[model samples]
Target: MTAPTLFSPLKFGAFELPHRVVMAPMTRSRTAQPGNVPTALMANYYAQRASAGLIISEATQISPQGQGYSFTPGIHSAEQVAGWQGVTRAVHAAGGRIVLQLWHVGRMSHPVFQQGHAPVAPSAIAPNAKVWIVGEDGLGGMVECPVPRALTLPEIQAIVDDYRRAAERAAAAGFDGVEIHAANGYLIDSFLRSGSNRRTDIYGGSIEKRLRFFYEVVDAVIGVVGPDRVGVRVSPHITQRGMDCPDMVATTLLAARRLSEKGVAYLHFAEADWEDAPLVPEAFRRDVRHAFGGAIGVAGGYTLDRAQAVIQGGWADWVAFGRPFIANPDLPERLRQQVPLATPDTSTLFGGDARGYTDYPRTA
Candidate 1:
């Protein structure tokens, strides 16, 4: 097979992607203190990888209350906005198109990271798993997740407004667009899954009701940046953070259909768990594509060959690479030229300095 099928030009939303390869969002936890603002080093990191067709930034909090871990960037403050402006300017100067991923961790937060406050969620249920958090010893560490308080109706509405505000900030900071983080057992995913949501209110119970918060969020974000500049991510069956749906197939199809009718830019689906997990079945991928007529990006455990096959088979318009891109800054060039990729240093993945963040050299 010929190399560079992944490098073919493609149009996604309002931007023309230089190639079908995307730098998928991965949390780096490298922001500054007090406000968790983006740093100058971060700007340099993104600028170095500007060759990517599209750069989806690491998950950024929409509000102070939305934070689940310490040192992750936020978009709700002037300092944070100004800090990100530097990043966006650097990326654009290097000829890269970038989008900010708006995120809220919901119940996946420890009280220590919450600034002496309890984390909020669709219900007062605690996750059955642990969450990564900063340790008092100053080194990066992990801790057990605290039980979160269920948000009142008014609180939920306020969160929607926060997302709207975050989108405005992203646009002002010069991002090409904004991607709502509705996947991976986050705030929106909490509501979508029956296991995490045990509320007896308008935002819970039936699938339609569970989807209400996400739809409202989309409407709010679109209001701020318009529908053409918005995108949403969904993880149907990754099963992370204690999230599971009784009917994964039906729920995913319904969510895709609803999002398609909304006229957003694109829908990103994490078809399956990436770590030693089965690939998404062919029938399910086709079903999702049929339900969602607009552009689709499939991620999670995709190699160069599998990515090309997915696009050629008409299953997805784009394929996002996470770990591969981490170790290879010139991932697209390497794939196109069939060059060997560098091994990623897993020890430096999270809460690291410039070492793992930007020290990855390109293929010579």
Candidate 2:
């Protein structure tokens, strides 16, 4: 039999991934009310996509203050842990490996979403963009992001503790591992980007300083989950929600090299915004691959052929699919069979029930 390309087995950290395809972390805002707990519907949704080598759950808030959107699952409280237990149970029952994505929105949150509290960040700077918030109508809505208060040194340390606690809770909840979401304009990403972090303290200024916050958080998470079971996500060129690195090459290279030194499980890098951005330059990909000795997973607007080429070329160890996995629940099966994918319904992408969440048809 011919060897499988996308279906080939691979080793990522402690787990032996059955395939090289991972379900990327995506926020759907469908958790249950009052504490943003994961629902039974979410369990069904993840279980349905078990064929992938691994599943990274939606970016989950580490604490109440970490939340920037309504109805998203959290891993802080006992109730939240119990809710995710159901999700992890379902995924494991279907013979799939799953990881909980730990997140903090920082200035990407509105006071309304923070329950009348100000948003927090490494520095007090307003993102030149907007964030999705819950409107007065009790539905998902958009609001201009407000200037966040620069966190005090003590508060910054506290947030690191929050990540440690969340990681411990994730393991107790039965997740195979945890992915630190240091990407996509969140708190850690904000600190890493010079445009967002304007602090004068040791946590800002030069590249080494800018990465201090991330290093602390990673240390805390690894202390809880161990380095072998923790992965991190980063997006160097993605200027989402008003985040842009002045020098993409320098910033990403520094971040990648630092992460590699930490000895985390894997590094998931989204080279560009998916909509209509340019492909990551081959040279840049190769540079990152060389910098980070650990496993690498690349996402954003990748097709089967392109993904296979990236893996075969040694640029990345695995490929993650976001929209493709959402629209095609059995994406791995479809790719193996060489079938066309179903179009994603952008209308039902966020703030919906199970219609767009779990109702995507599986291949027969």
| lDDT, candidate 1, 7-35, per-residue tens | 78887568789889898998888898878
Residue 103's C-alpha lDDT in candidate 1? 96
What are the Cα lDDT values of the candidates? 0.87, 0.88
RMSD of each: 1.9, 1.8
Looking at candidate 1, the ten consecutive residues that score lowest on lDDT are: 270-279
Off by over 4 Å in 2: 1-4, 274-276
**lDDT of candidate model 2 versus the reference:** 0.88
Clashes of 1: 0
lDDT of each residue in 1-364, candidate 2, tens digit only? 6444677898857878988999999889888887898989999999999888999999999999998877888999999999999999999999999999999989988887667878999888888777776766877666788888999999999999999999999999999999999888989999988889888899999888988989999999999888889999988878867787787568778877877787888999876745678677889888988888789998887899988888888788899999999989889989888898999899888887888878889888
